[model samples]
Target: MSKVGAADPAAVLKSFSSHLIAQLESRPVKDDAERAAAIAVAKARTESTVGVLLSAAEVKALVAASTAIGVTVRQDFGTRVTDADFAACTALLESRALDATLALANTKAGLSALRGVVAKQGAVKAKLDELTAVPVDDALRARLWRVLEAEPFDARATVAFVMHELGGADVMREWMGTKESTSLGTHTEQVIERYAKERAFHDVKAPPGVRLEPMLRWMLTLHDIGKPAAVEHGDRNMQHAFTTPVLVELSKKLGFSEREIGLMRAVVDNDAIGETLHWNVNRDLDDAAKELRALAKEVGMAPGEFFELQSLFFVSDAASYRFLLERIFTTDERGALTLKNEKFEQLRARVAGE
Candidate 1:
């Protein structure tokens, strides 16, 4: 006669962890011990099998749970299956089999399914814990990622804001600083180069006696400076781009010249026009190229001479401004040609005539 024992923690943990624990408990096992082994071997031919060695405590709980639900236990070590193998087989016995004896025979196959569930439970729990430890919901994390990719906020401010709000500042910092940083946070030199290229091309022709290069650089830089500040706001107000005037005020306090302040102000107030203009027009330039040419004509300056003026405005706008820059300057068709001097001249003459 089999003796009854107290429940084992490990055994209960495993059994309770099953997705079908409630159902498993209600079913009863049919065959006795010796007959169950013969059936397990018969069914093992078609099933992918595994062996398990249960602790003595676990064995007792298994017996008790199984017996409470009328599960049959077969103790047959004589067959090719080892004690470990037979223990695994015993786990497979189904209590609700239509043919009670057949359930004992298919025990090995049943064990194979149970093992799969157990392994899956172990792995899934580990993964879930890893995600939870980050202290933010996955959906919220994904939203933060979208904001990062948008680069809609100031770099430093955005980083600080995200860290304060979300709890994984170090990882985010590493990601932002890495070579894999998004376009806005990517290499600063490349940004300068691209800004230079676009600024050199705004409008049909460089205005007579106007310096284009320096002015354009300054404008682009200033345009994006407020992204970090705006990110901190983290609201639908979309006030980052609107705060250019404030930066102008700050620059004046910092001793920037009146003329330099105007350039910064222009960048800050770029959106104030009655209507948003096309990217390449003389009046509503989207990026540095048009702005440089416009400023040069307005001030009767040249590209190189205006470098300091441009750099002042450029650096102040910060890295977050890339969002508007990309949208305004991007061509609808990939690889479209940007305006050159000749093209600029033709367009200018036509506009002048009109």
Candidate 2:
């Protein structure tokens, strides 16, 4: 029976829907894929009904996996690039001479000298194919190396291409199989715009080179997958911990090193520590570091690596929270960090208990 005089329009709609559903004819699902998709949606609806609202981060990660990782079928699934893109990428890499234009310098000796390097590159690519299951082209490899090698640190080329490959603006709750910690928008350019500026991108640093910047940016996007502090249901760090398997799954697909995965976890596992330290001021810097060092050890990072990686992670993360960390600490020429402050008072409130 419909509620004719219900005070709420929504109550009337619900009564009408219940009556309508009882009269609807049953239909079989078209196929297994459709059936599975329906099941997944039903499960998600049930969960959302129970009130742990799927964080934007969780949805982003799941959607990327579904689209690109073969977890679910999509109408646009087979849109990988063809002919000229691959050819051009291949030609540029093989043609560009280490010395300038390999073709021009080709005495027999010069060509002979380059053979070993070329062969070694081929061997590495073959191994990469076996590991990643995507017969990635030399062009993509060279471009990624170039991005990592670019001075002043840029990843736009690779990130943009990945955005395209992962459905670009269309499917991007996030593209590239990761989610942003803020804004939860479909675009990632906004997040990139917010990142702090530092010099020394790829153009090849002697030791601690441009790799760190891109890696940090890439994984920071993963840090808050399901971790929106505003509407989040539970502990943020714990939720981050719950998402580690998803992180590790994506990390393995991307060919990240174990050390790098550990760094990602370190950043996510303790993301809010800086804010807590600033607000409470119960622990001094040394005392606070002891807590973080323990976390670094649990993640199997060296104290040195943790100190360097997490400090950068801290300042970058802190800027949004106004934790006053970026105010004092700064990175060196190589992007290694140092807390170059004599003023302890700056880290805490101007007056105690104020």
Candidate 3:
């Protein structure tokens, strides 16, 4: 019935050591002196084991817990534990446990150990959620815009900043875990910036009174929001494009008009238009053009405007994957996918004529 955090480190360590001694006592120790020696060694080993796994924040929490229980822990582990010490002890323990566990046919203990590891992961995720739960407001949004302007290439951090502003840090973390090499935030940033530059240069057409920049930004930001949900539930087949409804609902709550939400959702649904163009350009130009026409109709965009928006995203998305551009493009030296690319130019001409 004792509270978990109320115990001092000395008491906790003592209890932990006692548990180890009890487990050891079941083993074939020779005499009372041997048992006493075993207990002493076990205490040192147990302390050395847990000390290495604790992070700086966890160590600070443990120290505070110790202080609350009237026990000083400053001199106990030299302020911090070394990684080598922890790793060595952990390897020893794991080797012993593996040997013993493998000796038995019924591997319930091994299963239990796996479950414990999973439980620890859950605890870490909970802590992350708590730490990232900053309230989204106008101030946070402004700060995010400033950071995006200052560090345009730091897409991951900028996207994290935006997610944090939208109160979606947990979602962002899940998405980030699934995409080790990809940066949704950076891709979105590049897409918006590319759209802006194109709109300034070309006669990219859109509906009357519709601001392209804000619409593109909103679309790109929430385009991949559903990715985390798809990843979390083991739904590997779920297309992230289908998640635009979530963003549409969110925009409604944020006071965006129905027409604005429709435009954003259209962009999201057609976000992968660039990928299709990239992969299918050589094999079936006519097929690619037909697909674009259908996507434009579905998203309620004119064929010309739809092609322009999708081309902007296509070029920017390719640019964002600079490291992987060689894999994406066949004859690219600098890995820059520009409007001058023959395939892209061909697609543009075909769409413009339509």
The best candidate in terms of lDDT: 3
Q: What are the RMSDs of all candidates, in order?
A: 27.0, 25.2, 22.0
Better of 1 and 3 by lDDT: 3
By the TM-score metric, which is better: model 2 or model 3?
Answer: 3
Model 2 steric clash total: 9
Which of the numbered candidates is closest to the native, going by highest TM-score?
3
lDDT of 2 by residue, 136-172 (tens): 4557555545554455544354445444432222223
Write down the lDDT of every candidate, Cα atoms only: 0.39, 0.42, 0.52
Instruction: Compare candidates 1 and 3 on TM-score and give the better one.
Output: 3
Q: In model 3, which runs have C-alpha deviations exceeding 4 angstroms?
A: 1-162, 175-203, 278-283, 298-300, 324-341
Per-candidate TM vs. native? 0.27, 0.39, 0.47
Deviating ranges (above 4 Å) for candidate 1: 1-190, 199-216, 240-242, 272-353
* Number of residue pairs clashing in candidate 1, backbone atoms closer than 3 angstroms, sequence gap of 3 or more or interchain: 32
| Candidate 3 lDDT over residue span 35-121, tens digit each | 464445434645432323433444465455444433333313322457855455446557667553344434666777888767644
lDDT (tens digit, per residue) of candidate 1 on 57-172: 54566556555435423222324435645544445443223453566657768988888767644433442243224444557545544443442233343334334553424333
